[model samples]
Target: MTYPEIKRFHSNMLESITSHASQSPVYQDLETISDIARLSQLPLTTSTQIQNSFDRLGVEKVLLAPIARFWYTSGSTGKPKNVYYGKRDLDDIATGFFQLLYLCGARPWNNAWVVTAAGGETLFGLVVEKYGLDGTISPLAGEMDMIKALRHASRLHKIDIIVTTTWLYLLINKIAKEPKEFERLVETEVKKKVKIPVFSTIVTKYLLRGINYTRLGGSLQNAKIGFSHAEALSPYLAKIREAYPNLEMHDVFGAAEQWVQAIQVSPEKDWLSFFLRYSIPEIAPPEEVIKGKEDRNYRVKGVPWYEWKKGLKGELILTRPNECLPLVRYPTGDLIEVMDPAFSFEVNLERGKMKITLPAIKALGRAADSVDFAGADESGNFLGFKVYSRQVSDALMTIRNVRWWELYHVKGSPGKFVFLIIPENNVSDETAFKDELLRSLVNMFQEFTAAAQARAFLVGGTAAMEDQKNYLELMITRPTAYELIDTEIKQRIKEGRSVGQLKPKRIFVVDSDEALSTLTRKKMEA
Candidate 1:
């Protein structure tokens, strides 16, 4: 049951290999994934290739699809990449999304509003609101427009569910909290609006921020259910629970590159149980990916999804039969941890109650994001320290009044680190802010640095260790500078960019002067 799509995947793989192997664009030479074993033999694929050369990636089937839709990622990595979906693929995704919505208490009678721009990831949610809900869907594009939409829907007493990104929700709440006439207007408008539920696919940091501002008026508190996905939920579920107490927070996991993978079986549980009806899943442990003297072949054989046991941590590999995109053992880049299977959970489907006990899964960021710092150990053995970007992001969230921020790792002989931040208006003490920010980063990254020191100690490279220590410079920007930076970002996006393609991380490695100059610009005429 875990790999119901295997036969289909094998057939597709065969067709692609026999018909288009030599001339196909993304992959030049390829082995056919005829069976589970052969699937393991296929080389891994990365997002970089998908972004830079998607047209070459088995596009024959895509061209032949009866109906095809194209969406591009927000070129945050440099250039926006296009993702193709066939009519059938989109229909499956839309159907799964709607089912998740229905499972989360949404109904056709409920007046739904989607507060996202009309592109990329938002398109899926828009589809769900349109197809799943019997109620009318109000698609609001921008933050101000979202507020207005909510107000209009509330005035009509028809707002049952409002869907938006967590950041936009926070922005709306922040504006409502301001002590201005506008705040009074928002408070009055919100108070008069219908108490509706909210759904968002967001990062945890913004969820906390949004929850803190939910009390601006009774409108947000009326939000009984909050469905979120696209990021880990367990880490921040407690905070969300404490904020609302009555709000039911559900997690739904999916990606633009792939269809919806999992959804919470129940609001009471923090598990995102995978649905086997989608793509066939496989798990590869972290250790197997590393090469040894005897084992030059590093990619470990991944276990089937059904074989997954609790506490198993590995990179998720998927095999899809969708003809528009034939993905065989494609490394999704997402690291996941397996959880216990649901004994039996019933979801009130559109027709009736459906029972399931699929194994739950937890995403642990991407393998690319967890960078490895290689050095020799005391015995002259090579040791690599994996520093997860999530650690840095988690530390950033700890800093009070930080509205948004980015950590840039500038490459050099001794690479320098720069932390740019936009603090909330209330954070006036810049000196204290810098001191606290530096302290937090140092503490969070202390273990990684210590590992480096131990590596130097083993190799007896004192000078090298000193250089490493010098490379760990952390710099924080002035709080108010983010306004100028924000303006510049908006201008760039306006020129033609989808927000979905933008990098979700505040931390990134900078390799060029052009990027540095743009990032370091401080003068503002506005």
Candidate 2:
């Protein structure tokens, strides 16, 4: 774990890495992996799910303690868990860095400043040292709080190279809303003197750095080659190139659990080459177009077709040339669209950080997101109504996949957005959740509907609603409610009509706090 074993890699990179994996007795017992991974068949993987698979397919003492550092995710909505990847996973993935660095024409002496999610021996930091990156690296300044750290590093220290996640860079832009903390942190890091580098991820997407350049001893900024992984790069970062024209921006296609997938030197237009990395990625989106024959649960179609003019982007899947993990064709939750005849897929700009265009435009080019439902504002913020209640539903997706969703009306002193988070599987989970939703529904709309006398029938018949829920409940009660929405959204999409956009209609807007009631009535009346 002292250094990241860096070496050049390319499309055939999988062969060499797996060749190394083949040397391991753990990987040698490949047949046992099926039971180890806990899958009848390899399906899509997110970091959280992979941890479970690792536990089932692996022993903690054998993998975690003996070989490497277990990398965990930020777990934005939940608790964090450590990732267990073997030495082969580390060794092979590093080839990607060597190859991409070679493409950018980098050197060994460059001072490295890693900006990945909390830089430590975590994944990226460990990889950098293994590769003999011969330079100082910066851990994420603290949960996407990188501005002060980067500014201080650039203006003061000696940074030569940079690597970090896309979210951290976006967060740098966000921290500005707090003026004092931003300035104070910058001033503090200045004393540390973390210089700019040739290996910084944030500024690497630059076009020129004549004036916006922070200098140390009057020298030009040093961090030249930048790698943005974890999430996709945004177009906002693209414009930064105007400030640091010499920087090299490479989009790294990999994750914590699985390590490296593919690498693209420039995502400015379309991803160019699929760096021969340790694993050959298979692109497949969830099955929405048709049903899965196995369980009939759901299935995603299409593979990463490198031949098409626009890259065939789907769920990112990987089958190592050596097959590091036990399963075959494990899908990564990331949605991608491949373009250019060469072997590259578009980073999903919709969900994570890599989106280049604005929200309005980002969804247009994509078929992966709520994009198929055109004309609907399937994605975007509805912050205005958020204060009224909790954001239980993804109201942003105008074109939803569920049978229907209700925006419950609440009249309370302390206002809340009573999102009757109905089960997408209400029909399957049966009357319990439906009844629960009904109770919430009654609680939300009872006063308003009763006073207005708009619809007594809707509230009075509780059993009727329960019956409806019973009939439509899904078979697989999704792990989480949000997951149900994600599953159903695609199902509704493939069968439904293809529209330019599908914007959600504001079915009900009840601002019932007495203070706003007068205004609400007026607005509703209008």
lDDT of each: 0.56, 0.39
Q: In candidate 2, what are the lDDT values of residues 134-194, reduced to their tens digit?
A: 5444544232234435454444345555665543443333342344454544444443443
Off by over 4 Å in 2: 1-58, 61-66, 74-81, 119-128, 141-158, 165-181, 184-223, 266-268, 288-311, 321-327, 343-526
Q: Tens digit of lDDT per residue, candidate 1, span 340-418?
A: 6433578887589977667787666667565444543221221344455556656765555666666666655434566
Model 1 residue pairs with clashes: 25-56, 26-56, 26-57, 73-501, 74-501, 108-134, 108-135, 378-458
lDDT of 1: 0.56
Best by TM-score: 1
Against the true structure, what is each candidate's TM-score? 0.68, 0.48
